[model samples]
Target: MNLTSSIRSAFTPQGALRASINLGNPILACRDADGAARGVSVDLATRFAALLGVELELVVVDAAGKSVDVVVSEQADIGFFAIDPLRGEHIAFTAAYVLIEGCYLVRDDSSLRANEEVDAAAHRVVVGKGSAYDLYLTRTLQQARIVRSPTSPTVVDTFIEQGADVAAGVRQQLEADAHRIGGLRLLGERFMVIGQAMGTPKSRGEDAAAFLAQFIEEMKASGFVDEALARHGIEGASVAPAA
Candidate 1:
């Protein structure tokens, strides 16, 4: 894939490729011991910048909504996010490069043993504010109430603090929280499969969008995504099928 000047200019209007990285989702991006950003999404951002022959400037944020805002407002040239229809209005997303399970966590003593039992009048589901699960549940769960934490990493803590009936988020995050907090267990099944993908502002144009889409496909087919996940020690999420 040759980089056209137009595409390069579209992605580097600020003279460098600024990528918005959301630290909310541990499976995609996170801070290392030195507080530097390092994860699967960071690897892809670096590779994409190298391909464009530009410097990489990371616009690191702590929440998914903030990452989306950065890209949609063109403050960053690109971002990593879960594929969702509401976000699509302002952004053009590539086909997903990873598939993550969205699961529910509840106190072990609770009677909610199945995913189907969650959407009842008496249950209160807590999720990360503006996360993929938040958007999905807001649209789908009619009977249960939804509570939001400030960020994905805080979902479980907020759930416990608020005494919410359930906490919803990435399976890995929920599992880790369950282990760390104790007395919590995940439902037997996942509520959703989140498709994680790269996106750019729609103002970047169709050519830029197409180039990014092709780049993601190449990354997946070439096993770059898989290797990055393993390098980051990311588990529970699988590489998305080629689009």
Candidate 2:
């Protein structure tokens, strides 16, 4: 895991690697009982720091927009994010390490029985502001009106409070909310599959990006990524297809 001087210099300019860990995506990150961040993304950042032979300084945030903003502003060296065309303008993504589902939730009696039924003009959908689901639906949903909540974890509450026709978010989070509150059912199938990846500011030279891409691919092939998911008891996410 020895890093060349150039790659190290480009990525870890401040000596220690500052990683922006977003806890918004429960499938990727979460806070444990000790209030410490622990999840797939946290594991990846830890391993990444080991590979780079540096100290890991975690810049934790509760929302994805904050994570992206930190990386783009160089407040942190890198962050875990969903690969989206819009984000690529400022960040370079490594090949995805995991695939997470994005699904819709509706009241038990709602007419939206299928994923495709959600895009009708009359239906309003609520999503987390700047989340992968929010960005994807915004681009692809030509008819449905999108109501953005302040954050991903609050989407369910926002949907219930605002009386939005549909709620969109990580399948696991939606399922948890449904179980806690009752009377909500997930749609038949997921509307999107998000590619969870590590991203560095595009301003960091391509050598750093290439190095990270290779590191992720190797981690997948070597079973390290799978081990992390299992260690964290994560489910409904799988190793992404090879780059």
Show pairs that collide, candidate 2. none
The runs of at least 3 residues in candidate 2 whose Cα sits more than 4 Å from the true structure, single-residue gaps closed, are none
lDDT of 1: 0.96
Whole-model Cα lDDT per candidate? 0.96, 0.92
Off by over 4 Å in 1: none
Tens digits of per-residue lDDT for model 2, 1-243: 447888888888899999999999888889999999998888889988988889999999988988999999999999999999999999999999999999999999997788888889999999999999888999999999999999999999999999999999999999999999999999989989999999999899888898889989998999989999999888888999889
Query: Could you say which candidate leads in TM-score?
Result: 1
lDDT for residue 7 in candidate 1, whole number 0-100: 97
TM-score of each: 0.99, 0.98
Candidate 1 lDDT over residue span 91-179, tens digit each: 99999999999999999999989999999999999999999999999999999999999999999999999999999999999999999
Worst 10 residues of 1 by lDDT: 62-71
Deviation from truth (RMSD, Å), model 1: 0.6
